[model samples]
Target: MKLFNSLLLVLIIVLNFMFAEPSLADPPKITKSPDYVEVTKSLDILQGQLAATKSGQARSETLSAEDLQKKIDELSFQKYALEKGINWGQCRNETDKTIAVYGPKPKKPKTPYDNTLYFLGAGQATPTNWDCQGIYLPNDTKLTSLNTDPNQQLEGAIAIKIFKGTQLIAKNDPETGALELNISPSKFFKSGEINWYIPNVSERNIAFRVPDVPLGGEEETD
Candidate 1:
């Protein structure tokens, strides 16, 4: 009787093992698209290059020609990728929103004097006297001047005179020899010429010019 009970138990265990289901394997991982992968790799390379350039610049050294060219090429590639709707590791939904808000945002159109301010000239002027000189400048122009004369010291007040038909419309006194003047479109509507005057014995070496128009749009005015 004992031998029969043991055989019955063994038979039940064998049946259970034979009838059990096999465990399923995990699903395969989905990878990023080829373009996406390429963009990520390019971004990594660009970051490294930029870091190297920054480090070199911090030490007052310039990057080699080859390195510079490589950076340029990488930037070009990134531009191209962005134009083709490639996002830098961002999800598709987020990228779409960004594109909608910012539009294409392609490279800015190259203007004749983009971000450039031409150096008109430098000369000396007498103090307490106003020279009504004629000059042309665009609307919302900025003028910067520095005293280049080593012999003359900045001791008194200096003013920039804006004239329209021999009438003084506006004046700005910088006080110091180094001066900056921001000319608005409303103030300089009729004339582009301005006078440099100092109200003392000191002479001023003045330089003046206009900055290029901004690329996108007019800057916000205070």
Candidate 2:
């Protein structure tokens, strides 16, 4: 019985060690810098679907050859866009008081801080000594109101100044294409998961090719 137990214990340890061995595949070069591997994969899948559609039309009695061709063209454009990549800059700003936001017309999300990737900035919750983005406001002015109007949507690349109460805290640099932003919660803003408009990326997507900060301070970025 003792011998059997020892043998079993040795087998378990051997299995554990073998399983713990690290993978040998080369690490991706962009591990330190951001890269768009997921986007490429999505394009690949779309292309595959387009191929499958073509194959199906060959076997199907219902889809006319012309319809199949149209599908190919549409999916081709989508795949091309994915390959080109979309540039979008977003940020998260927070406040003790309620923050407001608007835009991306045809509003699916009804409130600010819904679920988009964004930079984080905090302004004064109280009136006095309230310095946000180097700005001060009157007590009744309420900083949250600055970017609260959902009726107005900012598009094409442009610098964005974030505020809380009466203070300007952070700024987002402009880009040449579509983007999303998050300006709320005022706290819990910096955590990366709160990344503002990642998956929601759509037609207006532009590539955020440059490093986040310009000649200004680092806080100007995420």
Candidate 3:
């Protein structure tokens, strides 16, 4: 009877240890699925193909633009899936609509600006609010004319003048033929223009207008 009781106590202790929760040091190992490996290999191949196509060295006899575009679209979808943490098996079968609903969105393309003066927001000159607005002059370009609206008075002075609603905020006179102004857009107010007098033999001038809100458009204010 004593022997039986000792064996029973031992069995209870073993059972308790077995049923206890695991310690932090004994965490389950994470293993990648076969599908994940296969998908990753496929993605690498697709990337290589894209590179070859771009470098004009595609193996195919004739790769049309349409075909190249289709490949790009497919790659984009797969990339979206991978970013969203979708399993490889599920991603492979996902429809465009399903992917759109669950996967990450593609980023918008960046706008390309050239040696021209234009408004900054919405990629159009639609008289946006002038909280912080200014012109972007490329390197080696010259400023032409500076003026304020409600009074088309040109700042004839051969100096840089920044204003906020007719009140001069800042001024400078670099006097260099090539100038680039990257000042904070907040210094100048709406309906203001800057003229750069290119110090060449021609003395040519270029004009840029500050963006303004509607009902206070450039023409109305000028």
Candidate 4:
């Protein structure tokens, strides 16, 4: 009985410390950096579906063979883009609703200080202080919005400064650790699941299909 109680007490203490808020002095790394792993797995499944379609073993109610191939091509490109990595940048809410994001901690789930909770307003963009290389938002990822007035800003809210052209970043292979080519990820975050960008991407090669627009802190870029 004494041994059981002692172990229970120790377990509780460890749990508390693990969930404790982190300090800036020892900023956390992105333990689950949005590497689009799940999305990739989904793509693999889609590939099987495609193969099944060709084999006449399966068929979609709405999509044709051409449609499936196009989708595969598009998703494959998004995978390629993220695997290359992105720059530490900002996230622009192209959404009409406000969104509160935690880190890719979404460490890069990203984390949020009690007040560090960033609420991205509709149609507005917020710059990140993240050092992540990629970000992804799953389909089931629910988003929220907060109502606030510009005149009634938060106490320690920092001034909004738009960044310049996207920085060129290299994408590396996870298994080989070999450096591939580089790219500038897009900074737009809008509706749809399967998202992965922002905090570290520019040039909008995303699973969520949004147009590529200049982030406007540096010279205009594609």
State which candidate has the highest lDDT: 4
lDDT of 1 by residue, 28-58 (tens): 2222444345445655765666666667743
Models 1 onward score TM values of 0.17, 0.23, 0.22, 0.36
lDDT of 2 by residue, 1-222 (tens): 999999999999999878875567565443221323433454465456556666774344554556545555644553444344332222223332222221122233344443222222233122222112212111222123233543344232122323212223322223311122333322222123443322323221322222122113222122
**Which TM-score value belongs to model 1?**
0.17
Candidate that beats the other on lDDT, 1 or 3, i.e. the better one: 3
CA lDDT scores, all candidates in order? 0.32, 0.33, 0.33, 0.41
Give the C-alpha miss distance for residue 44 in model 1, angstroms: 2.2
Q: Supply candidate 2's per-residue lDDT for 204.
A: 18
> Between 2 and 3, whose TM-score is larger?
2
In model 2, state the lDDT of residue 135.
Answer: 20
Better of 2 and 4 by TM-score: 4
- The pairs that clash in candidate 1 are 128-198
Q: After superposing candidate 3 on the true structure, give the runs of residues whose Cα lies further than 4 Å from its correct spot.
A: 1-31, 62-66, 86-222
**How far does residue 78 in candidate 3 sit from its true spot (Å)?**
2.7
Per-residue lDDT of candidate 3, residues 72-168 (tens digit):
5654554454445432111111111110001111122222321112222222222232221223222222332332222232223222222211111
